[model samples]
Each structure stands twice: as C-alpha cells, then as structure tokens.
Target: MTAGTVQALVVCSTASGAVTSAGGPVSCGTDAKGNPLYLSTVQAYVVDPASAGYFDAIATPFDYTQAFGFWSVAFTSVVGLYFACLGIGTVVNFLRRA
Candidate 1:
C-alpha cells in the first residue's frame, strides 16, 4: 500500500517468523505435561520422571531440548488474504473509469 509497508514486506518477511517464542539458553525437553524441563550444566538432560527438575544433573545420554512448534498457518493464511485484497483493490481501481 505504501513505500514503507512494501519495504517492511521485503525486508522482514523472510527473516521474521509468523510467530515466535523464547526460552532460556540452558533448557531441555518438555515433560509429558508440556512443561519445560531445564537442563543442568553439570550433565546431560533426561526425561525420566524421577530425575528431571528445575535444577538437577542429567543422564549420560542427553534427552536434548525439543523445539516447540511456532510456524503459524493462521498467520500465513491471513497474510495471503491481505495480499489478495491488495491485488484485488489495485485491479478494481485500474478497471474503473474516471
């Protein structure tokens, strides 16, 4: 619609995720309850119900932190709809007689 809007679309669209989340640098896989299990610096992280905790040593084989889903299908669909509306508006304006 405007130069600034176009510039933002070109510059940030590729790099910025539709949605995002943040977590601590030292983190580990989530529990079955969907809660984050932070890993200890001393050892590898594990998912064992008895051992995993806010601050504790991990097993020899690291359970490893898992990335949660962030890609937004809804946001992408809305973006697509916005572009479609822009296209349609431009076409409609071009076809109209003064």
Candidate 2:
C-alpha cells in the first residue's frame, strides 16, 4: 500500500457482540446466515499533510540536555578506567623491578 491507505487491519469481536477496529468504527450488518458482521474498508487518500515536518531541523531542547548527561557519564567512566589501568601498570612495574 502507498502512504495513504492502511497496509494491514485487525478485527476483534467481544463476548457482548460488539466489534471495534484498531480504533475506528465501521458499518455493521448481518449476513445471510443471520450472524452479526462488521465490515472494515480502507480508502486511498490523495493527500496527507500531517507527515510534513513543521518543527525546526535541529534536535529538541530536552534532547540536548540528555546528550550532555550521557556524554558526561561516559567520559567519567572512561577516565576512571584509565586511572585504574595506570595504577595497575605502576604496581606491576614496581614488583618486576623489586
């Protein structure tokens, strides 16, 4: 399906004989066998304007703060590990010399 029409659909019937779509409601009818039936139809849309981006090209304001926190935690962990390795190497070198 194109950008307009729904690609797939799912139908469900409750114990109370009520049928509902994913969220929308369609027409109800009865078949020749006298069973309640619900029909879901999809129509093609020639134009959809909501897909267009109306916000700015840059990231959201909150995302900038989140990114900063993420990098700060990452760099702090990296620096801690670097110092740990350096201390371990110094201890090993001193032991070898002794």
* TM of each candidate vs. truth: 0.28, 0.39
lDDT of each: 0.47, 0.59
- Candidate 1 C-alpha lDDT tens digits along 1-98: 11111111211122223333364333445667776555332222334444344235433444333222234666788899999999999999988944
Please give the lDDT score at residue 37 for candidate 1: 53
| Number of the predicted model whose lDDT against the real structure is largest | 2
Count of residue pairs whose backbone atoms collide, per candidate = 0, 0
**Which runs in model 1 stand beyond 4 Å of their true positions?**
1-71
Output candidate 2 Cα RMSD: 13.5
Candidate 2 lDDT over residue span 1-98, tens digit each: 23344343334222222334566554465567766656553333432344333333333466778899999999999999999999999999999999
Lowest summed lDDT across 10 adjacent residues in model 1 is found at 1-10
Question: How many angstroms is residue 53 displaced in model 2 relative to the true structure, after the best TM-score fit?
Answer: 14
